[model samples]
Target chain A: MESDRSHRASRRRFLGGVGAAVALLGSGRRAGAATPDPAITELPDWTRYLGEGVASRPYGRPSEFEAHVVRRNVAWLTASPESSVNFTPLHDLDGTITPNGLCFERHHSGVAEVDPAKHRLMVHGLVERPRVFTVADLKRFPGRANRVYFMECAANSGMEWRGAQLNGCQFTHGMVHNVMYTGVPLKAVLEACGLGPNASWLLAEGADAAAMTRSVPLAKALDDCLLAWAMNGEALRPEQGYPLRLVVPGWEGNMWIKWLRRIEVGDRPWHHREETAKYTDLMADGRARRFTFIMDAKSVVTNPSPQAPLVHKGTNLLSGLAWSGRGRVKRVDVTLDGGRNWRHARLDGPVLPLSLTRFYFPFNWNGRELLIQSRVIDETGYVQPTKQALRQVRGTSSIYHNNGIQTWHVHAGGETENVEIS
Target chain B: MSRFLSLAPALLVLVGVLALALPALGQTRGLGRPALPEEIKAWDIDLRPDGHGVPPGQGSVKEGEAIFLKQCAACHGEFGEGAGRWPVVAGRESLVNENPEKTVGSYWPHVTTVFDYVRRTMPFGNAQSLTDGEVYALTAFLLHMNDLVKEDFVLASDTIAAVALPNAGGFYDDDRETTEKHFWGTEPCMKNCKAEVTILNRARALDVTPDDKGAPKVE
Candidate 1:
């Protein structure tokens, strides 16, 4: 008890010292020569006292200092919040795997808070035997596998189709997240029900208010698809569809139906609203492209972006993320002077197929302006195209699948801004 | 002869065990029960483009206009022009323009999509609240507003597919493999790709992005 009182007294003294330093700095006086650095000289309150016990936070959360690291949404992007999207804070995150709570959310209606006890998944239509499995029943099934994959919304950089629109990377290229999913193979589940010989496509439906539906090819479902119930070693978050969700590997994120409730095998594709009216890409020649599922190779520099600008003058680390739907990212090329010159970035961690790969480039910054960019080459040997190259082929009419290289112009004063370089 | 006869019983036991395990391995683990027909019917609300799963109902444009004014007019404008940021459902603007207005009449390839999407999820919040007859009416009214149907025209499951949208021929299957694959070269440029880099556009100048203070308050 005596130690606790002394700790409180020391904290008060520390806070008072901080206030005095702030006042001295605010008065435009040079306090560095007159007073020593308190951060190094004086002991902090955290060091003097014992921290909280393990039981304090039953589950756990990021540090209070990291409260700013959160999912953010552009308010005017959609009509209502229920049917809108919130972006992942890529600039603030490190490593390849995204935290469960910080994953971007794109919902048609709203996040459905489903009760695991009452939730049921129905497999019907052209199957030999239509079956219904509850959440508990799904868990008991055999052949559960864990796999890491990246889910990128088809519209990750859609707003930039016209040009550089949003300032921050969070808004520009943040509609993606990488996570380890634990679930049963969709093929095993389909084989259990016995698929019909003529079944070609299957409609995966969600239980949200929108009843989101998308037709997925049967071939894709049989290979690499999963009925995932957990992500990042924990139960799926409510926004990510609790209890169960469909994981369509290497495909557009929209097809990964959340709050998954039904799978109906059919002979042909169901041209649902999502496939036709929305996800379809419109061309400048008055034509549209349907069933464009695969998200091509893309990369973006997270640090030194608009949100996280360069702050130091020397010995800084440039970090970014690269991913491809086709396969593993073979290499990531970084350019400090726009696209005039490029260098191979070092892939730091695990490089798995259909997963985000973290890369870093250490360089010395001498307070000069820079036009930074990164490009990715997937295992398929397909190189990421420039924005102009993409616009020439796709035109400015597309709202999805804009995997063009992004440029960040850093000012001499260490602030960065989103810009398009010619 | 005595040794051979003694081993026959052990071989028979092993064969019997194999026979029992093979069938179990071939079949499914058998975890869930068969879905009853009634349960399937309750949840099977999706509709295809060929009018396969559409329910039997009929509604006229006049009936749909009344339902739209009351339930949908608050968001979707009275004349289907759209209220606020809601989608405009009546426009037939040209797609080959700087800012094309992709409405039901301009971009939707098939009329069945109108009926299927409306029947499955419509009116935004109160989805699946509309009856089959109301859905048919609402679809007919939207078609009338888009000038695809006369004011007195009636819409039903049998006739829905015949009402072809104007952009029916404007859509094609994804051909990116041929159209855009050539752009992705085997070896990307490494040095001096551009003689000089010039800034063409800046996001800060547009200033349309939502600021930090205006973070979404979605529940």
Candidate 2:
């Protein structure tokens, strides 16, 4: 059967080309070889209506496919790429702000541009009022509020206490974020500068060319602090400090000093080499801790983890992210089998004050091989440890508090591999 | 910041890995490319040390002593000596944590951060396009090459805050209390984490290491 007569003569030339496209659809011709209306292949009913100018947004970004949510680092640590710092993706992000182009940067003298209407913020020396303002005079002063927090980066787990290293959480847990912020409360601009009851330390400083300075404490600058100018709402996005900065929520984000400028109020604590010898911690008894601050209570599960995987396998979710500079996160758990049996996890939104909450968990993979891990806790009940209980309590001569608990294996065909279960 | 990862329950969870590089939504990606602005317009510059964001151009010290003897005294030796070996912009004063090396009018600490670092990086072979009177006569001949001021003195932006930096009050601001209540509780473990689950006994088990300095250093 000569190949079944060439498949019945190519099925009668495809049914004689479908009967000349049904006699060219009533003979007006233009039917098959005319495949060119694809500029949109569909959708143009006023672009499926969501218009009427959909409530304006003169500016605000993210969702151009998240442009890879940027700010990364670890170029062989650093020798100079105009001083360094770049960490901010926090597992593809979710909920609590952090979007001004993904936040986390830190430069020492490079990214300044500084023009916010010729910027100013100059508070100057021993004040009774040595003013300068503008960024619209500190957004026209007045309580302002918004809050939410978590800043972190006193070297968030400076490369594990000797383990897991980097394999992505965008370089492990991406520095830190959690946003909300807006501005002004630095105790009503240091009580409008006139509180000299022997001042006791203020020195802020930062106009950048490495003019970076610090030295706050006067009771956390009269508690809560935030000369900010807005984030998650607008304005301040010249790399998170356009016309002012100094939020200090949950501590350590280079003591929150970006493009800001001068403050003074002094009495002591100036030692600045970014706190003598780069964010000091070097211990193991050779002595070196200096004001460790506090960001503690950690957590991490981020989808299957190594950059996420496992797609279709009976219901799953297992999200993550938690925070703690001292308050919210009350409970996170996770442990798919690492700390041997554990669960809980829901959390989600407003876990406010020094922010970042999120958490989730649902599970049911069945493809086998997992291990996960999370932990957190917080609301003044700090939990997150393991890395063999933080190097058996801080020993391996520290390198800025490593926070700990983070694992994720997952195999069974979905991949992902950062491992550390013991 | 944020380097500790660990991950192992077979392979560290970060599932589905779309690799977040977002920025692409529906189509048409072909226009011979070069408009670049569907958004991104922030542009920061930072320049403090007191002159804050300085970008208007003003340098002096008599046109910065003829462009610091024509682009910084032959590799900075006509007085910034330390040449052939470079650096040595004059001896670092008290040498703060008394170092072993480094000088720029004695361990820098603000003179508007040496005119915002020679108006944005000095003649390290051209940077930020200097010239505010040759960065104020090479910051008044490096303040007479560190004896601080007077070679007939002359730095400008109206005297760069009467120049007084010697680690302008060194620095500090972390006031530690790390959210007390013992850094927010936990660590109780409901019951003996099995006497802290003993581990001891690894003796090196590394991989992926390649920090490439010469491409070799193993166990």
Candidate 3:
């Protein structure tokens, strides 16, 4: 009886509030009619006219006001736009999946506009029977699979290894994107070539001006790699290797050659320019580490970062992205007092192996200073290391695969800046 | 008929599964036509470290210099010292120790990479346009600029493999699987993981980080 009475009382109170609001609006309109009215109470011009109807915008687009949400490139990072990278707008995005358009782009030469009709995939060298596959031929293969995976440049947070260099997470950690790929397993296609005993390596080459190529261990080629033609249920954008691209899960983005055209099976690694001269990690001891494929577990708090700072003091949702090339992210811990104390963050979305995962932690701020950070632990039980810990081994020279912890110093005035805590 | 034939295998497998009988191995489904010998030769441009696929060509250092100036000098500099932020193709003899300057001369293991990379992607705008002889000439020019070969040297397919890099022995296979094996531990410390912590540095101190134009307005 008491519960019913309380429910009735709440309904009556809500109705009373609505009645009072209507009365106030009526009185204000009547009073305004007597004076020179300045408010926008009259029907607008848009309401007076019939707007453009169905099929007006057959293809949808974001509102004109949201023009700022775009992939950005740093002017001084490279000599020209052709050989540079554009960072994804991670600060403007929520959830795990990155839209196909907003995904980061890294090109060695320039984006190739390939004609699918003319494009052909040649599988030759060290095979029982070499085969040539047109686009239609590739589509006819069985065991077509769709999977969501994250692709990260080995140099994602490389600049911050020396110190907290980039201000925003978009620049520091935005060289990564997660998307659902519709593709055929590379193993299935390689099987058609009839692998020989000496075929230990597979060289994937692109058709762009660069003709960018990388050698993959035959074991990895036959494991979980893919020849993807579509991303997020749409044909790949021209910038993203239109007809096809190699999707080597859990490996550096360079190995995932785009605009894929050929695959040559060989007995040994090619040790090409990308693997030797570029992607190799330089150590303090003067020795460089080559073929370091796996990207370790890493995480960064996207919000409460330099780009997305706290606007008000009260309830704030601390959200970020955590991922690992090895497997699914098992746990993410957020620290408020630097590294002294940490709280287990709630995993927000589906946690798939080798895919980006979102995590969130809600907290009420009293407008005090805070040093925010996040640490990720993957399925392999590998904990994300501190910047100091990584530097002890790498010594600040190794550029690629710097999965160190990131810190954001949040001030009492609702501003945050990238900082390093030792 | 083709659809029915494909479905017959699945139906047989289903019946075999219910009867606990081992299903017959399916035949390899061949879809595409056999690759022609000319098609294979056309796309097989990769040159291995052991000098397997180097085409029959000869290029002199004198001829290479002219090609370098015409084709590669814009990005790589006339003397291979590099222009602006492009790769410094020459010099940096002993700098890999202290503050490393990893140029082609100081680093890079095999010389086959130079030949393959130049032929596959060079002149920046127009790739795969260089003739085999021109690629040999460019390789010889880079070798001369690196102080490894004399000015009169002619680089050919047979002579390329013997030319070793200075830092050929300076590399090692990835040992992270063993070196960083200790990093994996299931139970990580949560509260009071460290006794004390201090802010050692800020990214803004160096004035390097880009301006946060997208920062939310502070109240």
Candidate 4:
């Protein structure tokens, strides 16, 4: 890795020398101002040597050169490694969808390795024919739903609730992942059991040691929830609930129970430990806001962030992600002078509802210091609020649901840092 | 409105439509068999604030303290004050100012949540190993430590709901749909959105963010 870094440094030095020569040749009329000829147009090592055969890596992985792209966790964030969260490298990823391997992981009692043969999903309580479904039995049901959705932890930017705390988008906006899930509709499974008239809530429980449970309203369970077994075109990675999981669209990620084992139909919410003691957002006045499920619209500048610094002064493509738990991101605006001026950024690729939407803005840089920010408006006409605006209402007491607009300060030396501008 | 009205021209046709949909409402295709009694008993372990699913057993505060020393003291500390970030459970009485210390005595809305959580995921590594009697005793001990009950108090399924938490009224239902309604709008200010913007805070100034090269240890 060190050698690769040095090689990249030399290549940059070579490019700088060649560009300087070309500029001198184009502008000067004096002698000895001509650009040098090409150094060596010879074949590299690959051209003379035999390459490795195809099956050398039957299941291929990323090349060694890209080793730096990885999920990272702050050691000081939690006490134990078992019950904590690791952030996704959002600044390193491109496009809207997060790759399965790079998705951020959060576990309360560590990941559970369950045998699919022994796993059973028991649906009881207010139902006509309460049933237990094995992995195979669940696949036999109809009305399979495949859709792309962004799952965000309610505490994605929780650390920054007081002020700008994390230096990179990977830490500020990384506790989220957008993926395509293939599963049967949760409504179909509930219908098979015959939901009772008074059934207004469903308690989804995990099989992990924590047995993490969350009470979901029945209206949402019937709306867009899924009994997902596959994600990103393959079986769910163990870190993200293997065998079966509940996909609660637009709700807080905790409600999307992983390693799902049982769901009980009930007339009222269970008010479990998760919903009351943990996920609830405390207000400034001492009273907490309970069951705040939807993650509001949020956006951030990816490139020229703390990690992905600007390296050149010419035209540069600034890209970032915008998403909403309410609906699709309709428009994204980029601000260069700390919200003093703004311009519409182009939305790239598919703009599906409740999914991550990519936005880009092209700008010619002259190595001047600037404050960059991005604001998103979702389909429901909800405008992303500033940190000041959110703080006025929620206060710094909350450690969850901090979806305030993020600011990145770009220095003249071509480095960036996280900052808050008022 | 006309498109939908044109389709339903007659009352007889509406009646016929209703007849077809009514049968489909309660119909079950019998794809999966009925859940056996034993299977339901195994997974139906959720308890509610109303004391719905607490197992029948009794445990005194004295019994709970003995069990806590053996099973939980390694992590929760001798007095439930918590050991090395392992969640403090008692004696947060005076820390309820600006930066509140949210312990079981001052924060949890429901005691049933405590009972249910401990019964299902307690002792950290050894979960669901505590008997019904032990869980009741632990509940009794926690209540005693919080001063909600006497040292000789005993907790059981029938009387769990009668015990109230100190901060039971500390929470309210979500009102974001109304409280934050002003955030929803058709147009937001673009040009001249702010004037004389100044930097309020910087992560670099705080210097808490870790180095980017720290590799995550995945289990």
Find the candidate with the highest lDDT and give its number.
Answer: 1
Best by DockQ: 1
- The CA-based lDDT of model 4 is what? 0.83
Docking class of 1: acceptable
- Which whole-number lDDT from 0 to 100 does residue A169 have in model 1? 86
- lDDT values of the candidates? 0.86, 0.60, 0.83, 0.83
Enumerate the candidates' DockQ scores in order: 0.44, 0.03, 0.36, 0.35
Ranking by TM-score: 1, 4, 3, 2
Stretches > 4 Å off in candidate 3: A1-52, B1-28, B95-99, B209-219
Estimate the TM-score of every prediction: 0.90, 0.29, 0.87, 0.88
Residue B10 CA displacement from its true place in model 3, Å: 18
Mind giving the per-residue lDDT tens digits that candidate 4 earns over A231-322? 99998888899989999988889999999999999999999999988898878888889999988999988886877777667688999999
lDDT per residue, candidate 2, A44-108, as tens digits?
87677765464565664555666745676654344344556677767677766677777777676
As for DockQ, the candidate ahead, 3 or 4, is 3
Worst 10 residues of 1 chain A by lDDT: A13-22
Better of 1 and 4 by TM-score: 1
How far does residue A390 in candidate 2 sit from its true spot (Å)? 40
C-alpha DockQ for predicted model 3: 0.36
Candidate 2 lDDT for residue A99: 75
